[model samples]
Target: MLLTAVAPAVWGTTYYVTTEYLPPDRPLLAGVLRALPAGLLLVALTRRRPHGVWWWRSLLLGTLNIGAFFALLFIAAYRLPGGVAATVGAVQPLLVAGLSAGLLGDRLTARTVLTGLTGVLGVGLLVVQPGARLDGLGIAAAAGSAVVMATGVVLSKRWPAPAPLLAVTGWQLVAGGTVLLPVALLVEGPPPSSLSAGNVLGYAYLTLIGAAVAYTLWFRGIRELPPTNVTFLTLLSPTVATIVGWLALGQDLGPLQVVGGVLILGSLVFAQLRRRPSPAPVRAAGGPAAVQDLNA
Candidate 1:
């Protein structure tokens, strides 16, 4: 739980890392760097390779979770106002809750639904500021990214890989990075002629610690916990991002953001409290055969 809790907090650094450390014109390059090398390193350490259905599954999961999602998210950030983009991303927890119920057959308690809604509303209240123009295309892209990510999360829980968590994450990163490399080269062009030391350090941190470590921990948490519960952790990301932006980048957090943060955290706690207990076992009335079968 501690690891799970810490992972998203670490992930909150993504916006700052991208804006501050990475070259501005190469979002795809940033994605590639974040994924490929870290993936290869994990694969080398594990010395494990996936085949057949696992290969296809990993590719699909990677495309949705990383490649397509990252592409759309970066585009949205570039084209849309930050607050609008963030509001679109903030809808993910609700999407995850709904998808988990349909796809994973998880019980969708009213409390869970309400909590997810509250989290979304809180994030919206926190991030949307006056004078921010909503770009329709960017909003669509951001919302699309959230939907794609939510699908990946649900599918991951439904069809988990038959390997250690790190190995699975490694393969997904490899697949995602491979998918992104060509796009990066074609669309963004070769990275700028010169690289800054700060950029290198930031890229390295995002690749090794952010993408590799954070994702491995996140997927492990998702497999072990309820999808809704896992997604609730995302609330932490925006809050952390807001703080990092303010302190590190001199971005301001208005009163609305603070209130929104409170609501999101409160919703998470409420959802945790509303967790349903396991159903009690029923006694068999017919015979011992029934009892044995039931036990089996």
Candidate 2:
């Protein structure tokens, strides 16, 4: 879990890096670069490709988790302020809980529901500001991103990969990057003619750290942990982003933000705590009851 938590924490740096170093208004290009290079490098390193079913599965998961998610996120970022986008996207955990309950047959407990709601509230307090304008399309995009991401999380848990962890991660990234490449070329035109040192460094950071390292840990978590449990950790992304902004960029960190951070952390902890089941009655190994237990 600690390793998994690092993914979102790394992601939190994206906003600052993008603003400070990346080319302006090139989200698709950024997405492509972040996903493809890391993916190709992983694939080359692992030298593993998807078998019969996984090609489609990789494509679908890639589209849902990375390609479509990035496109919608781009729209939301363009139309909505950062706070509004973050607040809207905070519904991811709740959505994941619901999907897990329906698809994975996980229990829909009150604690889980409340924790998810509290997470949204916390994120709202942490980021959403007063007088934030709403665009219907942008709101839709944000909500869609949450839904697709939630579905991706649940589906990934549902479909355990046959390939090694890094190989599977690489396949998804490659597929996602492939999906984005044409769209980026058509929509945003070609890449910028000249990239500064900051641009190269920023892209390198995002590709190597954000996509490659972060996503490997994330998928490993999904393979090992419950879907809802993993989703709760996602709340950390925005919280970390806010802190990065405050410390690195000198953004405001008001009292409300502090409370919000506390709430987010509380929810994360609450979700991870599970009630221990009562122990089975002790019995002799060679007794009739033990024979009955073995028979049953």
Candidate 3:
């Protein structure tokens, strides 16, 4: 659970990293760099490559998780204002709730549904400004990214991996990066000719901490915990991002966003409460509470 919470906190840095460090025009390159090299390094360290069924699984999971998710995320960020893109992405928990029920046979508790809805409402409050114009393409991109990420989350749970968490994450990154490399080349061309220290450090942070470290923790936690529980943790990302934005980048947070942050946090706590296991039933001298009452 700590890992689950921390992973998204790290991920919250991505919005800043992409905008500040990486070239604005090369979103694909950013995605590729984030996934591929870190993945290969993990693979090399583990010396455990996927074969046969695992290869297909890695490809599918990687595409949905990293490739499609990152591509759409980059596109949305490029096309839309950050707030709008973030709000669209905030729909992820809702998507995960629905998909987990269908794919994992997890019960869709009413409390969970309500909490998730509240979280969405909070996100709306936080990001949707009055009289702000909408970009159709950007909305689609962010929404699509959420769906792809939801699919990946469900599939990853459905298909258990044999490799260690870090190794599996690495393979998925490699596969995602490989798929993106050609698309990036054809569509976005090569990266910028010159780079700066800040650029290198930002990219390194993204690759090592964001992709490698965070993902290993994420997958491990997902494998151990329920999908809804894991998804609920994402509520923290926007809040963290907003804080980081304000503190690091001097972005301002309005009253509405602050209220929204409270709502999101409340909803997350509520959802977690719903998912927590109840204490074991206690037996009385006569019988169980309902049973004893019936007898009495």
Highest TM-score: give the candidate number: 2
Q: CA lDDT of each candidate?
A: 0.86, 0.93, 0.86
Task: Please provide, for model 1 over 1-296, each residue's C-alpha lDDT reduced to its tens digit, 9 standing for 90 to 100.
Answer: 55786778998888899888888878889999999898898899898999789989999999998889889988898888776787788778789888988887877777777888888888788777878887788988999999998999899999978888889999999999999889899898888888899999999998999888999998998889877788788778877888898898888777888889899889877765654689998989889999999999
Q: Compared with the true structure, what per-residue lDDT tens digits does model 2 show for residues 1-296?
A: 88999998999889999989999999899999999999999999999999999999999999898998999999999999888999899889889989999999998889899999999899999998889999999999999999998999999999999889999999999999999899999989999999999999999999999999999999999999999999999999999999999999999999999999999999999988887999997666878978788778
lDDT of 3 by residue, 71-164 (tens): 8888888888777788888888889989998988988777777888888888878766677668899899999999998888889899888888
- Could you tell me every candidate's TM-score relative to the true structure? 0.90, 0.94, 0.91
What's the TM for model 1?
Answer: 0.90
After superposition, which runs of candidate 1 have C-alpha atoms over 4 Å from their true positions? 276-296
lDDT of 2 at 62: 91
List runs of model 3 lying over 4 Å from the truth.
Answer: 275-296
The RMSD of every model to the true structure, in order and in angstroms, is: 5.1, 4.0, 3.2
Q: Who is ahead in lDDT, 2 or 3?
A: 2
- Ordered from best to worst TM-score, the candidate numbers read 2, 3, 1
What range of 10 consecutive residues in model 2 has the weakest lDDT sum? 281-290
